[model samples]
Target: MDLQESFINSPDHHRIPLLSWAPQTPTAVLVIAHGMAEHAARYQPLAQWLNQHQVAVIAVQHRGHGPHCPDADLGHYADKRGWQKVVDDLQQVVVHARKQYPDLPLTLFGHSMGSFIAQAFTQKYGDQIDNLILCATNRVDKPKLRASLVLVRSIKALRGKRHRSRLIDNMTFGTFNKAFVPNRTSHDWLSRDPQQVDRYLKDPLCGFSCTAGLWSDFIGGMLDINPRVWRKDLPVHLLAGSCDPVGEMGRGFSRHVTNLRAAGVKVASERLFEGARHELVNETNADEVWHHILNCLRPETHSVTE
Candidate 1:
């Protein structure tokens, strides 16, 4: 597999970093949108795995993420229009991938926060990609989300856009660790594997708090995409962990699938890993997760080629 790094110049002049892995003979292309407060490099293992299976992978780091982002801050998509700009960044990456490999069928894979972006992207550009994969995501309750946004916005107004609010962070993520009481780390909710949790904790970019402005923008984006009509014919695959708090232990995942089906979407498949956490790709049973994903991507094949 060949691994490469490059940068794309967004129209707003923000330099977005991308990491890509390609095999000698590729069968398909997968573009990844990573979850919040993390960089594209974290997905290297997943990318390498896909590459070895004759799939090319390209992953983009959001505006406030990765080492090459112009700003040194850990989280802040932008002072204004941050969420839209992130969506635009995904569009730009998709255009680039299409140009680079016009013949390969393209699939968009997103996890957690990235899954929200992927849903919005499909609503806007459903025709651009052949399939969609949403992992570790749920259909958020609009009322509660709006209330949280209002509170965050008020805090932003008082402390300024760049202010990082531990209050907001706690309100959003504090309870996730509650499920694993006597946990070794605050991020134990991320995976069952202690090594993965430790690695994430040690990574400077993995667990930082985002600016209030980012929270406001993210909530706004979530509200905007929640009610919009999605294309009925788009093929979608939803994956979640049975123990993932974000998915409400699979209840939210089921509701999301029901919503899509109600909207006339063709949900190709849905799977909930019984013992996994929020980050399915990094779980102890990650190989099983990958097996399910491979099956979804290549339904015609019975087994993954070595």
Candidate 2:
């Protein structure tokens, strides 16, 4: 694998660190939107595997994430218009990809929080991408999202935008781990693979709580996504874990697909792993997931959830 490192200048002059894995004469290029609280390095194995198949990979460390965070504080997006900036940051990545891998088909692969960013990107720039893959995504109820914003606002008013409130953190992610009682780690819901779970727990940048303002921005972005009015003629592939609590144990994922269909996605495909959890890319059957993803490039959308 040929690895390259560079820095992209965001609209606001933020220095966004980029990681690339390229194979000579690539077939396609993949621009990755990584999940929240984790950097782009975690996706190295997947990138390396894709390079072997002649698919190049490019990923960026988001505004408030990774060791090279240049603008916002750790666990925080900007205090205002943070979500929109995150979306813009993604666009910057796409722009970089277009120039770096010119004339190649591009796919946007987003996981968890990055899925929300990717969804918003498709809504804003549907004409730019060739394919969209949303993994571990969910539908957001508008009412709950509004209430969450209210709570985040109240907390921010009291604790400040940069404050890391345990109350807010627990309110957001506390229950996901409960699905697996007698758990060995707090992020057991991330994967069934113990080594992967341990890796996340050990990484300093993996599981930190975001600030109140960042939560407000994230949920605001979610509110903008669900029931979103957008149309695209491209293939959209949805992937998730059957028992993943983030999607409310699969109901939320279903609603998201329904929403996308209602919003006029031309070809939509879905697949759920029976016993898998969040972070399908890091799960034990990750190779299968990767192969399944490659199969989707053929432009056939299936309704079956196998």
Candidate 3:
């Protein structure tokens, strides 16, 4: 089925926009949140792909990102202060969705920055979700790094309150360099797929630099919330690339999965792809990633009844 556009008024009084796609026989619902600067519409292909497989999808625009954004510099997410606000917004969206489709199993999928929010949301609303997936996220360690982030972000947040730039560039993805980065850098350092990178560049809504405030808020949120808090109670799946920058050295993004396991969280599984980049969902081997996700949607010995 084709996508249908809709909007919900935020409890805080913002206009929240969302897009939905329904298949003929729906098996489950997947709600997606796009990364920083980008809006939910970027997931059009993924949503359509899910719909073709009988999975309904609802991609919600983060507060500052899409039509809801009041300022060009601030998309669905602002900074740490607004991070929880974004999480609350996501919770509200999920609750609203549950009310609308009480019969459908609900799962949440977040990529990059969205993954950070997804992890926190899962912690806040673990009982509400049937399954949770996070892609291209890292655990926050090193208090020194956190301190540096906080210090830098404080300056940005102060500036954002008064004079903030309308456009912000993000170095998280950095420039696609082969030697300094991975092979996927040839296509797009962030994603392993050249076609996907090409499409992202061509799409006006796909790429934008995040603000200093956004970065600070993200770092604060990361430090404040430990995935371990929600790791045990939630059925979570994390997918990351071994060679990806996030997992480079002492960070040990994969080791964090084991930490989650220790906390007693039912980690459905954690997959580490060899040459994948940050955006595994947009990578050349994304088909393989898609298959793994489908498996999460349909666990072994469990069949879709409808």
* Candidates' C-alpha lDDT: 0.86, 0.84, 0.71
- Tens-place lDDT digits, model 3, residues 1-306: 787888887666766788888898887888887787577877777778878888888888886687546666454264336778888878877887787678988889988778878878887887787889877766656675576686656667667632333332333444324425434433356665677777777765656555666666677777676655674655788888765675552146777677777777788878888788667777777777777777777675344332
TM-score of 1: 0.96
lDDT of 1 by residue, 1-306 (tens): 667999888998888788999999988899999999888898888889888788899999988888775454679888778998999899999999998899998999999999998888887887898889999999867888989988998999999999999898788677888888897889889999999999999987788888999899888888887423776666789999999999988898889888877767889998888978999999998888887877777777547641
List runs of model 1 lying over 4 Å from the truth. Answer: 70-72, 226-228, 302-306
Candidate with the greatest TM-score versus the true structure: 1
- Estimated TM-score per prediction? 0.96, 0.94, 0.86
- Shift of residue 207 alpha carbon in model 3, Å: 2.7
Evaluated against the true structure, the overall lDDT of model 1 is 0.86
Estimate the TM-score for candidate 3: 0.86
Q: Rank the candidates by TM-score, best first.
A: 1, 2, 3
Candidate 2 vs. true structure, TM-score? 0.94
Cα-based RMSD of the predictions, in order?
1.7, 2.6, 3.7
lDDT of prediction 3 = 0.71
- Runs of candidate 2 with Cα error greater than 4 angstroms are 70-72, 226-228, 298-306
